[model samples]
Target: MGWLLMIALAALVLLALWKVAGFGRLGLQLAGAALLLAMAGYAWQGRPALAGRPVPPPARLELPESAFAQTREAMLGAVDQASFWLRMADSYHQRGDTYSAAAILRSGIRAHPRDPDLWVGLGNALVVHADGMMTPAAELAFNRAAAIAPEHPGPKFFYGLALAQGGRFDEAERVWLALLARAPADAEWRPMVVERVQMIEQLRAMQRARPTR
Candidate 1:
């Protein structure tokens, strides 16, 4: 019964190719031969009687949005033209659509070229889109944000984050150290930076202690 169904399906496919796909006589013959060979191989090795098993979906890598949003608000302030665009991009980022998030940030940057927050957001989106690698464009975006607001913590903090994510721990440490040196004692985001720096130090120590191949 299973063999009959397979043959019928193959025949229907060949007929469709001949009629709808405009296969010539020679092409139809070649396709038929290929189908026969496939059937023979299946008969020898395929297991048609096995029960189907459900496959769990692969895990998705995503940003921690709540912590991210809080940090952004703390560093860049809570309201502005850039804030609207950042929120819109965050919605897309939360949905695992990093491309759209980056695109939206690009649009926002075009409209407000000197908005440091938007540039930082674009850098972040681009890094996430590239699966945590800090691409040249993302680096450019972070640099632009820093150039626009020399004193802003958002650019340096998030740039260091992208560096750390890409395993450039030394560079991340330098960037965060500079930020910490200038950051005020009572700044809301200072604690996060301190924690991240400590984490990076621990990671560096672990790497040093790892057994070499």
Candidate 2:
């Protein structure tokens, strides 16, 4: 908005110059027209959204794509368990088939509705499926996980990443910072959580400095 105002002021100066100057009238008119066009562009860029919204960036996950299946299976166990199903879903997710990952989680939920971890996994898959947009279903999935297991870090961690992906960096940072406070001193995932929180803080600072578009 400030940039647009600055451009508008510059255009007014050109218009004023055109009125005062005997020669170079044509040049002044052309320059004023160009400045007006630039102001319009600046105003458009400052708008929060356009008629057709752009696709958001994809969400980031702590587990690298390669670690999805093998790591989870080795650490969490077999197919009948919800964690195993989460691993299977993650395997699909790693291949860019978020729909398949979501489907897997839905099936896992049918068998293990009480499992908060499965709910969190579904939320993560849904966020990815939506290209990092926080759809109502994804929000519900995360909320369900939090309700089922208030103390669990899985939902908050993944949901924070989703929030960050959607350009809600402040909210993401708040969620992560709170989660970090609750993390155990010797928790294996603590370092990763701390790292993510710090990253979000840096991202928030960058966002503040960035011009809106």
Candidate 3:
């Protein structure tokens, strides 16, 4: 019976704790008392006679590639040494391992200190790792990237993205507006920026119309 198996398992655990784990007499007594309390609680509440059902496996978490990856490759060269590191980080990011992605970017930054693309990637990884919140460290990484390449669009675009994701929509709009002002008419990524700005405006309008309790 389930109750018999439960008691046997508890006894085995207590024996291991007392012998292999070197618990003293008082510790063993306390552990035994805790086990008895747990068993008593189970006896009162548990459905021991119910048929056992198979537990379903957990669903897999599928992470997609960054939306800005293509734009980044367009702005920053795809064949450079920095790109190798970025690709490595991207692999980790796609696997839902943002911490490892950020760490890999850090190592890349150490090797290529002035690589703006690597810094941008690091900022993104940090933001994702923080559950879409724009942490101070992520902001610093974006700023460093911008400073390294004053004319590059990657840092500003991704920085605005992080800000928008963190619910700082107003700040994101301002940053994107500035980028648009300086962006060339024929720039490939300019259309994407314009679209994002329009989306932000719509979001703000919806927020204003929302009824507050």
The numbered model that scores best in TM-score is: 3
In the predicted model 3, the residue pairs found to clash are none
Ranking by TM-score: 3, 1, 2
Please give, for residues 39-72, the per-residue lDDT of candidate 1 as tens digits. 9999899998899999998755566683346578
Query: In model 1, what lDDT does residue 34 have?
Result: 95
Candidate 2 residue-wise lDDT, 85-202, digit = tens = 8878877887677788899999999999988778877877887788778889988998998898887676777778778778777888898889888878987767766877888778
Pairs that collide, model 1: none
Candidate 3 residue runs with Cα over 4 Å from true position: 1-60, 75-79, 209-213
Clashes of each: 0, 0, 0
TM-score of each: 0.66, 0.58, 0.67
Candidate 2: where are CA atoms >4 Å away?
A: 1-80, 206-213
lDDT of candidate model 2 versus the reference:
0.75
Estimate every model's Cα lDDT from 0 to 1: 0.89, 0.75, 0.87
Residue 21, model 1, lDDT:
100
RMSD of 3: 6.5
